[model samples]
Target chain A: MKRRNLLATAAMGLLLASGGAFAQGMDKVKACFVYVGPIGDGGWTFQHHQGALAVQEAYGDKVEIQWQENVPEGADAERVLTQMALGGCNIIFTTSFGYMDATNAIAAKFPDVKFEHATGYKREHPNVSTYNARFYEGRAVQGHIAGKMTKTNKIGYIASFPIPEVIMGINSYYLHAKKANPNVELSIVWAFTWFDPAKEADAAKALIDQGVDVIASHTDSTAPLAEAAKTNGAVIGFGQASDMAIPEYMPTPRVSSIIDNWAPYYVKRVGELMDGTYAQVDSWAGIKEGEVEIGMITDAVPEEVKAEAEAMRDAIAAGTYHPFTGPINKQDGSPWLAEGATAPDGDLLGMNFYVEGIVGDIPQ
Target chain B: MDFGGINPVILIATLMASAVPILLAALGETVVERAGVLNLGVEGMMVIGALGGFIVAVQTGSPVLGFIGGALAGAVLSLIFAALTQVFLANQVATGLALTLFGLGVSSLGGQGYNGIKPPPTEQLLPDALADLPVVGPIFFGHDWVVYFSIAMTAVLWWVLKATRVGLIIRAVGESHEAAHALGYKVNRIRLMCIAFGGAMAGMGGAYVSLARVPQWVDGITAGAGWIALAIVVFASWRPWRVLIGAYLFGGITVLQLNLQVAGSVIPVEYLSMAPYLITILVLVIMSAGRKANGAPAALGQNFHASR
Candidate 1:
């Protein structure tokens, strides 16, 4: 009878030990990434891939990273997400605005899986998070340089799409350019694609032929800079998603650039997942948080001009300056922001109208 | 609203450069179809050529050698399709599509480290004084050698298809492979040669985009240019000169619409972007309606069996 009592106690202890193991979760965290374009695009996807590499490097053997490139943003994205969840992925990052609906839908179906969508604003599920960089801050710096650098008093913009994010960038750039040189006339061309090198090059050529001496693009290739390089300093352009200075065309055509830094954010989120402290939240990091960065300003710009641009960058980083400070008006000439007033996040998030002096419809 | 800066001379010059890639690909497809094969892998071959040409150009610093490398890569790739469909007797349509999917994957894999690299510069073939002539100079003399090569290939193909005895054998084979086999002509051999030629031309077209026009490497750089070349072949009724005309028409519309956007014309941007595809469809409809009998080769998609 005493021996039977001891066996019963040992059985109870074994059951409790199994339960504790279940509560502690698996040994390694599986993280997956879905990219909208090939990592060789040399722009947007390439930067995101760098972030994924950082996550792997930070955790070594504790994390397993898997990614699939060139995943289209439609029904195909849903299939990919479902497969990732079934394949034991604990966290998934869908890196494009178009994947917002798919990310939210899949997150609801797999409540245990964590999702992060970039450059989007829908968060219907508790497991879904949204993150974006304040790219317009970098655009403001580009505008200041473009305004000072333009000899023709004309600046051309090659826009990708008619979304609020792109519209805001256009307004921020034009506003800062006009602030520096009131005579600067801005011309906008909507390319309607995020990554087509040939079309992007053609757009750059058309703008140059129109006598616009300064160019800026919202697209995701270095084609525009290459086109500008052909003119041998007659035309100047800024790099779009990364630093695109080919040594042969350096310091002249590609004067400055906007760089997307997503490594720290990825590492942090993965760390949270590993520590069992992961939560769904909206993360909109800017220059201050090291999300948006301005690339090297070449020596081609005058010393005073470069210094002025750097000062503006520092001020934005330190919270002393905002890109949307007003005394600004809408395209229809109505006051949008009063003097000394800054734009609210809500208004900036849904910005669809052009500011005063940008002479074109927003293409509804 | 300003059409003042839209110079006609420069417009035509840009159109000529843009048309060369499509013209070259379509012309090659014309020859392949005329030899009784429907290879839908033009896109696959073109992208492989783009990567191969860019790599060689960056490594060797010679655009000429780059074009040669691109052509050779495309031919080697097409040889795989030729063996599967010609020897193993696989379905041409399915094999062609599989080739395209395989090519896109392989090229993207090979293109990992080659992105953002520029090709060696290609200079204009004509001298400066001649190229700088007032109105005709920009239109006629300023383009690189590839543009002239496209035109030259069109003329040469036209003569080969209509005048040569070898052209007679290809036509005979395309019309009825069984009858050509009876005539002691090697049916599968001729078809293999045509497929290789088609692939080389498509590769050169892709090289033109990477080496001369946009002049950089990007994934899927030959974006849908191959499919458009296929459409041109159909609308041209497999005629080489007609293929040239169709390509130039498409190229002209593309150039004109972009210029209109910059000139600030009143048309909507979306509609202007759709203009080229819409017009191409309309032209195809009209051309098909005028020609009652089908222009496709009688034995186009059929597999051959010597024992049967």
Candidate 2:
């Protein structure tokens, strides 16, 4: 069966070569996105949808955008990707880490169709390209702010899952917070959910009750901010995937936010497809590449603290500083990086341990 | 008392608030099952209620009227199930499942513009003086109006079920619809009222979540809360007061688990995540294994025909 499939792929490649449709660029490209959560979630999936919209606006008539929201990340993803591929999708973007395997499986089946998987490292097929933002860079900025802004000397993280993406963010947040405040204590609350507002609210309340004045959540909802809003001014938090610096929680609960700017990446990839320059690339861009942005810092932060945080942000964007620089130790107190050395991309992508000071298991 | 930073007062208060949605929803399902009808679409009614309540709250800027609108919307949707099962004599289980799917889809469709919109805060029923009375103040008095309303509903439902003739008649119809019909009571009519009542309760529960708890509109906002409510009804053995206990136990465990995780306890937080459902399952085993408890209404989920 494998031999037959390989022969079929070869024949299709030969036919495509003879037809020479994509030899230069094509006039029109249909870009598709599959989201893991509802676009109304106001966070991760919403930001991705914003990126999809930017692709449409970038090329008015040259690109046709199609998307399916709340597509679960297992067998269902494979079926959706297969449907999109069969429906003549020029390029399909699977916008969740859980969809990695499904994306590659479908990409293998449809060798002619290009596949892009976000925040995932697996690219078993050449048509598949992996892209992720160095969110820890933004985490460094937020953590620095969290450490500086806390009145209780304790901060909390309402983490969604134990994935590397979330782990690295926590590590960077704690490390930066500790740097800003020598006596800072970090509390971690694992909610183990992506989008349940009630549970997320409970997580936030738990932290607030613990006297953790600064809260950070990896879950995709405004519940954390809403909970912080109830605290009046005792608790402050940062927006997760999107800029949640809305009026209700603004300048107080939401001191700042880390906005995931996928517009540049989306438009660039789709443009490459149209311009016949698209190829497999493992792109991991951050603040420097404008894929990760520090949202507008509100006036709630003290002047000097805000200036320091901005300087750190500038350093990250300028590629002169790394959030996971050396002088770091694993949770067990073994040195992971030497002084003056930065974390390698491979280590960051596969991060599974807490940096020394964070007090809790990763729920392996 | 603070046990490893797990404050008893805050934990109880948070549990009461979090449990209100499930408590109200389970109470509604208990009433429906007692009336000899099994409406498995509580989740659907609740989500529709969430959307309806959120829309009304956003439009009128009144959390009270928004709750009423949510209840009304749930009643209107359940009337479709009532008409299908009670009137048309369709399969109750299938119709109920279909209602859930329909509710989720329609609410998401209706919820296009309501995203990220926070409803007006539901105010506390008691004064700040009463709420600031230390441990008792926060635990018993600091909660908003819906928490009190949920407790009142449990009492009212219990009175209407255990003592009153209205409760007796409803149970008579539930236990033996044919006998009730022979004695000149309209079983379907009684069930129609009960089903609508159930939907309103479920809808109000959904509204409480949107307007009071989460206070934002998201598609499928009720999540699987309705199913949990259904499980509680079975676990409660169709008793109203037991449903209240079951709901609080579930809600308390959820709150407790979060607190425990924050305290960095020795208990595996991963296991704690599933503890609530695990207890529900355990209670279900005990209830079914030991037959001394009150069981489901015999006429539950049955179609009634006057001629037959």
lDDT of each: 0.86, 0.90
Q: What pairs collide in candidate 2?
A: none
Model 2 docking tier (incorrect/acceptable/medium/high) = medium
Per-model TM values vs. the true structure: 0.93, 0.93
Lowest-lDDT window of 10 residues in candidate 1 chain A? A17-26
B194-239, model 1: which lDDT tens digit per residue?
9999999998988888888788888877777889999999887888
Q: What does candidate 2's lDDT look like per residue over A121-172, in tens digits?
A: 9999988999999899999999999999988899999998788999999999
Instruction: Evaluate model 1: give its TM-score.
Output: 0.93
How many clashes in each structure? 0, 0
DockQ per candidate, 2 decimals: 0.52, 0.62
Q: Which runs in model 1 stand beyond 4 Å of their true positions?
A: A1-26, B1-5
Candidate 1 local lDDT, A17-127, one digit each (tens): 323323335456778999987787778888999999999999999989999987888899999999887777888999988888999999998777789999888999998
How much DockQ does model 1 earn?
Answer: 0.52
